[model samples]
Target: MKKDNKLKLNLQAILTDLLIWIYILGCVSFLVNHWFEKIIQTNFVVIFGVAAGFISFILGLSIGRKIFLPTIKTEGKWYKTFWGWSVFLLLLITFIVGWNLVEVDLYKLFAKFQNAGGIMKGIFNPNMDIFMQCLAALAETIYLALLATAFAIPLAFFLSFFAARNLMPQTFLGNTVYIIVRTIATIFRSIEAIVWAIIFSVWVGIGPFAGMLALMIHSIASLTKLYSEQIENINPGPVEAIKATGANTIQTWIFAVVPQIISPFLAFTIYRWDINVRMATIVGFVGGGGIGLLLLQQQQMLRWQNVGIIIWMIAIVVWIMDMVSAKVRGKLQEM
Candidate 1:
């Protein structure tokens, strides 16, 4: 039986190695064909290339398994192992392909550096005339983020218990509800606030309201995930103790779960608010409203100095929000 088990393990390892070699051969063949087709231009060359690649891979794998692999195993250096080298080569190939696909040109950046001088100058010397206007816009941005966070908190707080694995009942109905809620949250979270902003902008006819809706939707999804994960990690002892008293599902959560997660929940909410404020500026670029719209206008009109002022205002507001959120989260952690 032990010999049979050893043979099974050896077969599995060989199968895995074969599959990996086939995958590598396929990728390399595709790349070689793509790059050389334009230059070589013949079926004979393509066929020969593939055949050569297959033979080379088989030979290398056999030789490596016999000699190189054992040498690397003795060396105890991961970088010298076949798998490590494979990963490094894969990353190198990906980088090379990606660089070509993107048409990266460092020369153009340096050549056009002088074109940005005027804009840079304007940014450095901000137009103070529009300071009040930008401040008002910045205020709108802050409030938009605040309202979104406030609205999402209660809904997320309610949904979290259902989404949490530990809190959900072990029955079929409870499992279904858990899955549905978690799937919906994941779908909503996967869609960025910017995309939601675009959709809402069209529906709501473009403004801070659209931005607010976008931020709120994203916040609800994000907070639900955070809140549920926190619930899952809570001390099971309190939960089991509460269940021992013949409490129902809801009571078990309220008495045992809520108390533990409140601090972390508050902290997560505050941190999310900070994120929303930064995102609000981006949402505005899509006409979701706030200082971003004003900044966009100035930029399009080449009013770099005005754009500079808006940028500074955004920077100041974001910095302040960051500091406040950090302090709030710190306090909550202490509690």
Candidate 2:
């Protein structure tokens, strides 16, 4: 029985090795034919290449089967079936197709570095003439994000209770309301804030207000999902205890659930605000009015000096916000 099982394994291994060798040989032959057909025009070169490749493949297979394959064993279920190899081949094909479709070229990327010195010179010697103007635009971006998040927090707080299944009454109407609220939130979240900005820019005729509205809408959807998940994960003990005390629904939430999730809710809200701040810079590209608008205009006009200043300003503001948010979240966690 042992001998029969070992023979079967050896046969399967040989078959797998033969398939891999055929695939590799085909790929190498195609490349060699395309690149060296003129350099080695003689039929002798083609025959010699094929002979060399076959010898190499045979040596590699012998070493792999005798020395390496026996030493390596995977006990996982994936290794026991063909599914793992199928998935790997699928990924390999996807990568090959995507590579050709994208026309990825490292040579082009390398060539662009030749012009980098001039850009760097302009960046280092930034134009200060429009300093105040750019600063005001930056300020407006921060204000817009803050205002949007402020408005979103309260609305999300209210909606999260409805969206959370644990908080719902378990009745048909309660389940229906949960599904509807969750679906709406998912739809809103699916559309990026930048797209929202473009739509609102058209609706409100562009400005900081348009950007604010866009941020607010996205923030509401995102925050509701976060808050609901947080509420759902809260300790159920307090909730049960509150119910046993004959506390009403709203009272139960206030006394039982709110205490546990408030810290995380604040943490998520702060993180969202940080994200909105970064997004606010981009929304301005669609005439949603902020530092990004100035940055875009400078870049289009080839005013690299001014563009450099804008970049630095954005980086500085983002760094500050990141620090502030990290500290706030740390404090919240402590509470």
Candidate 3:
């Protein structure tokens, strides 16, 4: 029995390693193909990608075994181990690649400093004439964020229970529900609100309504993730006690889970509101309506003073929201 158990564990480890290698191979191959296809100008690009991926897989296996296998002693200096060297190499490679990809050049910044003088001067002397107009737009931005958060709260609250692994029943149906809810939330959350805003702008026309919808959808996904995680971290003591009383799943959640998560949920919701407020400005650049749209217009026309006014207003409003949300979340934590 002991031998058989050891064999089983070995098989499982091997299978897991194979799967990880396969994933790495696929990603490396795709990246190689994408970046070299045009330059290579031949079917050899595909072959090169495959070769690169194979080499990467072999190296990965070697490094993984050296770092993880029990044959390596843990008492030595970290830099003397394979793991430390691997990390150093990884970071060095990443920095080199990132620098090339972003085309970093410090010389141009200093050389072009004088070109921005007009813009800086205008920003320093903001046009107060458009103060009322910018204020109204800022108000609309605030309201848009507020409405999105308000509408998302109940839906997110409803879906989070289904997403929480510990809260779901240990049955096929329960597992299916958990997977489906989690998948939907992840898919939506992966998409930025600005992208959603672009889609909705085309669907519902360019206005605050479209922006509100975009923010609402994103908020629902974000809040569901936060709420589910909070539920998962709750004390098992309350849960077991509720189960001992012959309570059903719903009753268990209501009695054992809800109370513990309420304060954290409120705090998370307030944090989301603060996030939405900031996102609202970004979405507006894509015709989602708000001060960002106004800022975009002034920028395009090179009306730097007016743009400065809008920027200041947005900064002020964001700062105020940040302070208010912080205070509210602090109070909730105390509760």
Candidate 4:
């Protein structure tokens, strides 16, 4: 009885697929009979495209039906289902549409490689004359990241208490404040570092200060969410014990929560500094005044040698920070 049902389903699907292809062919024949000459003048590209599209559609439908449409009689639920296949087909169709809209041509990408290679070769011979200036710009970038992280860490620490759900009841006032703080942090985080830099640049006139402001605001939003989550997940025993000892809310937090989180908080702050250092370079492109500003200027002026030196410097700094941060985090975790 199960075999009979499975056979019937497969037969029905094949018949449905045959009819769809027949209908497509009929439409193509009708078009060809009327507009053969006009299509011929444009060459066979259009006809080939239509035919290839139909062939691909039929092929995809056949393959997808076999995989997604479950025919197996199982004792338990099957992973392959009709609805799952339908969603898969819908996503496939969307991808095809997007690919066409983008007009991605690989030929253009290949064509540019020669010129790109020639420019890259020039970068091998870096101009050492600008090394001092580049070093200063790189130093400024590091300073910006350091300043931003310092400013944001303290602010994030305070805001996290208000954001932690475990600390606050779901009462009207508590819930309202939680929602507002969470929403604002989300909104701030959604705005990219570069966009923030642009806004601050306009407000304060372009400099490292603008970059610092951008990184600081973004860090606050990110660290608040991170710290709040840590607070929420801390050991409940200590919190309860502290409260039982007649400790007030602030006292409970300081004695119980703060001790648990201090190590992780320090680790998180160091990681953020590492991230900010990288971001400072990028934000500088929008007149935020870091090494990126210098790099961008060199690139625009066609000074690939200078740009190469700056690139190497940035790479070295990032590598060193990554190593240092890993060591610091490891030590913190051990503690």
Best candidate (score: lDDT): 1
Instruction: Please give, for residues 188-303, the per-residue lDDT of candidate 1 as tens digits.
Output: 99999999999999999888999999999999999999999999999999999999999997898889989999999999999999999999999998978999889889999999
TM-score of every candidate: 0.81, 0.76, 0.81, 0.76
- lDDT values for all models: 0.83, 0.82, 0.82, 0.81
Which residue segments of model 2 deviate by more than 4 Å? Answer: 1-84
Please list all clashing residue pairs in model 2, or write none if there are none. none
Per-residue lDDT, model 2, residue 17, is 48
User: Cα lDDT of model 2 overall?
Assistant: 0.82
> What ranking emerges by TM-score with the best candidate at the front?
1, 3, 4, 2
In candidate 4, what are the lDDT values of residues 1-335, reduced to their tens digit?
98887777766655554443444444444445445633333334445544644454355544224443445332322235433454455456556545555777888888878878645865787788998999999999999999999999989999999899988878999998988888999899899999999999999989999999999999999999999999999999999999999999999999999999999999999999999999999999998898989988998998888888898899999999999999999999999
Poorly placed runs, candidate 3 (over 4 Å):
1-61, 67-91
In order of lDDT, best first, we have 1, 3, 2, 4
User: Residues 97-154, candidate 3, lDDT per residue (tens digit)?
Assistant: 5665687899988898999887897889999999999988888888999999999999
- Residue 150 CA displacement from its true place in model 4, Å: 0.2
lDDT of candidate 4 vs native? 0.81
Model 3 clash pairs are none
**What is the per-residue lDDT of model 2 for residues 1-335, given as tens digits with 9 covering 90 to 100?**
97787777666555554444445444444446655753434454445544543454354433224323464444456544333443455457556645655778988889878677766876898888888998999999999999999999999999999999899988999999999999999999999999999999999988899999999999999999999999999989999999999999899999999999999999999999999999999999987789988888888898889988888889999999999999999999999
